[model samples]
Target chain A: MRLRNLGFVLLFVAGFAHADTAPFDLSDAEHIKAGHKRFNKTCAAYCHGFQGSGGRAPALNAPDGLPPEQMFTVITEGRRGAEVMPPWGTSFTPEQIWELIAYIQSLRSTAPAAP
Target chain B: MRLLESIRTSLLSLIATASLAATAAAPSIDQAGSADPTNWPQYHRSYNAWRYSPLEQIDKSNVKHLKVAWIHQPGNITHGLQATPIEIDGVLYYISADNNVWAIQADTGTTLWHYVPKLDPIVKEVFYGSASRGVTVGLGKVFLGTLDGRFIALDQKTGKALWSTQLTDQRNEAGALFSSPPQLAGNVLFGGTTGGDQPTIGKIFAVDAETGARLWTFEIPKDDLKSWPGESRKTAGSSAWMPGTYDPVSDTIYIGTSNAAPDYHPYSRLGNNLYSATVLALDPKTGKIKWHRQEVENDSWDFDSAYEALLLKRDGQDLLVHLNKGGFVYVLEKNTGKIQNVWRYAENLNWTDGIDKKTGKLINPVRPEVEKSKLLCPNLLGARSWNHGAYNPKTGLWYTHGMEVCNYITSAPEEPGPKPINALTLGLEEIRLTDPPGKKADGWFGAFDPITGAQKWKIRYDMPGLCSTLTTSTGLVFTGDMRGNLYAYDGDDGKTLWQFNAGSACRGGPISYSVNGKQYIVIPTGLGSHAPGFLAGAFPGIKDLPGGATLIAFTLE
Candidate 1:
């Protein structure tokens, strides 16, 4: 009986966690500027290149970047196995994470036109 | 019919016994202190970490006739096989990326067995810490330090798991994985983890090789926690990430330590971080420090002293030669960690006005500031990367690769962290590669008088050569480069003897050994490390350089 109740609790938690979009305005200009500063200090110096174009790690501005829901999940709780990346849940606040998402979207929009 | 069967069984038993006796005739790796001409028994070929083979069968005259005998391709080339292969009896053993162990015939590239470790599914540290440098073979068992936090021993004969020991918590500490092979010191084998770049204070542990029991643990950071201010000591890093060499004469294990936390920014960690960027001589039995020497006091440039220590005896004095990534070579007394001499090795050092040659006192060293970009000479690629250089007693010269490059670094303050574990607190806003003061960015491979800092002969490379240099008794020097070309030079005067393009970057160490009277040259070829990616902006061709994982063995035709 307890196992069944626990399974239901897990299902309920999963349902609320999967969101279609971020809580804040990812299209906001100020949000992206704040995130650009954060990304440069942490991510851009080494792993992901400046503007998240790519370095040792994958490019965040690629055309097929992760969706809003998946991006939130990966950033909140790091993903391992083939997709290997560290979690950022404990480091940043929920509001700050949303700002990073906005900056990532901006990078994609500002990427150069292909030949 | 029964009598005939009994006679045949007896004959088979006799043959098996004879084979055992014949193999025993050889000086087993565990019994012998150093690697003989026929076998490469240890990580740096021996406890001293010389990376040199005394075999003279293949010399400069006949090295041109050398041909590729065989090639073994490991299918899982995730980050590329960056291990130096080891040989015992007639079997060659190597650990590829993700801790996959393979045993192949030393003469031919026949695969005998392969051990693939099932790592934790949730650990994200495997990508940057992918390549397993090599494996330890002794006590009739092969030992591997995994990407996750386990030290495992496998049956050397069949490549089966013998025992496993959980050393560190890879989940909590993301960068605390093992990228180097465990070095076996007598009955105990010691291993270190990579927490130098992360927040956790790094640790090194010694374990019993036979039973896989914990012996003792040694932490690189200070015990009193006085070096760091505030709560920074709780997470400040001083990683011990490389294998150390043993000195039987002094009965001590000498190992080097990496840089402090927040590699570039040093506000959090104030005083000279006692043990970071230092070398410690420890008691092998108790794992206690005997003597220690801090190479760089408060190293703010990521200049790790975490390279191998080459033991040598000069004028009846036991001395050790250690090269720091900060572009200087130090000679220390092996018995007691006394700095006998210090000389600059790389020419493009602008981090400091100059260092006192003998006393090693800094002369107006440049300090980084918040939000201000300071162009440091070594950069973090290091004036010299972690890959090793060769010291040949025969030629009386050290063959090494000196990278003449610089990086523009801008520092920024880190927010006070009770932050998440596995988070790197590198206080850097931007790090871009650029050329040095007067020269264009390039690499120089040369032969030099180690003690006097005199260059005998030098060769220039468009891009830096990243492989560990190897020297042999036959007066030949071998090293691999970024463009996949393996060049051999005359150890005496640095003349190009032979060269071969491997079609993939040769980023692993080259070794020499003999099997059944035929000498063999083996080098693991691959290129997927952070150095190549970090250096992409400076070198044009590196952006498109290919990567592969193959063990190529060469023998004279």
Candidate 2:
């Protein structure tokens, strides 16, 4: 009876830790930080501008929010109509690319909020 | 005995006097002030095409004290100005966007004369727009190529048109006479650009310099059957967009041509597609092909071999070095078109395993297969694009800004529907962002040994695109990045010597000249082309970058 009780206690602790550690919802800060890091690594400083306010590339943080999946598609699949945007799917990993999408989404609310 | 001795003395005196006069009248090519190193008289400064200026007044020590002297902004966007201005007698002559030829004062940036052509409206619609690379000044005239298939000679002193003749007949829809400046070698030698979706032909014309009469026209594709084969000419629309280099010593003019039209599909055009994406050496006086070497065979990626073929002599042998959009640098014996060496200076290429040295043919087995994405290196822009490369003879180093990246190409299905205007069929599947193995991620200005095709040194940037290379006699190589910062590097070591923030991306090549013994470096800075549009957004520091076109000139204080 004592051994069985000890096993139950250990199982309860393990389940609690698993639930806490799982990535459920990323905060706005986390998303912004993730996006900013990827942009620096991939886009550099001339096309998108220093602050994502748009220079050569289009403004990413407009009021009309970019769909997260569409943003992912654009960055991964690329748009060939006019602007020669090279697709980034082969160069970057899927998880990292998704992080970029999350970060672009975070910019929608705070980009013009303070300015 | 006295009479004979006096005669010998008189003879010696006469010989010495004649030698002195000959030396005074014609100075050697190396002596300063004889040729006036301060004045950039021709495209590459001299007939030898050495971009190096002998002026050393603006050395490394005083270059840091340089300040802006003047700025001339022509607010128009056709194609960002690519022509390096030719300076003659303190006046600078250059072609601006929209085919306007402007003569500006080299010292003050004052506009002296502006010549604009009245082009046909219908012809202009199908054309790739109009822009002048520069004007060739010879025989007391300024020569320029017009947008609507015409070549005009204007008086250098005045902007008035001296004579105008059709280089290509637009009525027959031959092709557009675009930006490549007409090179004059006693005769006006020019080429045409046509790779549009329409069925047009490309030809190089040598017209009489004085009367503007056709001297000779060499059809690029030597296939006789294709000249009038059945319904259409087989070798139609192989454009030669860039200006050809003239070798007066050898009596040859070398021209590099663009790719076959409908650029995505190569199978439509059978055979190697001669002369398209090839470098042809022709007899300037006769317009006969001396020798020709194709850079890319059956080009499907729109890889035009239209960049300048910089002529140089290395190791006591004359060599013609040409850079292709396919990321390969080919060095050929200028006399025979025999390729001496080939090297892949840019990494991340997967199109071909290697080029055969003996045959000068690419060993590309992975032909364009539909649906399967074939990743190719150098992308459509190639390793180097239309920007002019600078050669510094003192160091024997060729400086060029090179792109190091790859793209995935999948052939698009062709439909008979109204071809979308400006429809580029080659779809870029993905951009390989990582720097090639063992190299830095960003683009670089590389100094290469032209003879051996070995990179002497490279100065890498934090950006992907850079303007053309500019070298000065002060041991400096000047280039700019997409982030608006102009850099002057040590031509010997690729070290950053000086930098100036132009507040926008610099699209044109830089030039250095002197006024009143004061040396100045001029660069056209403003909004130009940029790749990977998210670059500014990815780096928040440059988001509100300034966008205004200005010709920034700097001089030593």
Highest-scoring model, TM-score:
1
True contacts kept of each: 0.23, 0.22
DockQ of 1: 0.27
lDDT of 1 by residue, B169-245 (tens): 76556547788888876678897888777778788888999888999988888866567666665666788787787
DockQ, all candidates in order? 0.27, 0.09
* Residue B96 C-alpha lDDT in model 1: 81
- TM-scores of the candidates are 0.88, 0.74
Per-residue alpha-carbon lDDT of candidate 2 for residues B1-557, written as tens digits (9 for 90 to 100) = 33543554455346434433443432222222124455666666654455566778777777778789988766654345556678765688877665778888988999999887787643333324444556787666888877777778889899889888787755345335555677876455555555423345677777777778878877675565442333224424577877777665565678888876545556556567777889888877788789989988767776788777777766677778888888788999878989899988876676778789889888963555555666656565566656667887677788887767544455543433222121222322222223344554456678888767788898666665446667776678887876789888888887887889987767666777776667878787654444334333223333455544567788887
Docking class of 1: acceptable
Model 1 Cα shift for residue B501 (angstroms)? 2.0
Instruction: Report clash pairs, candidate 1.
Output: none
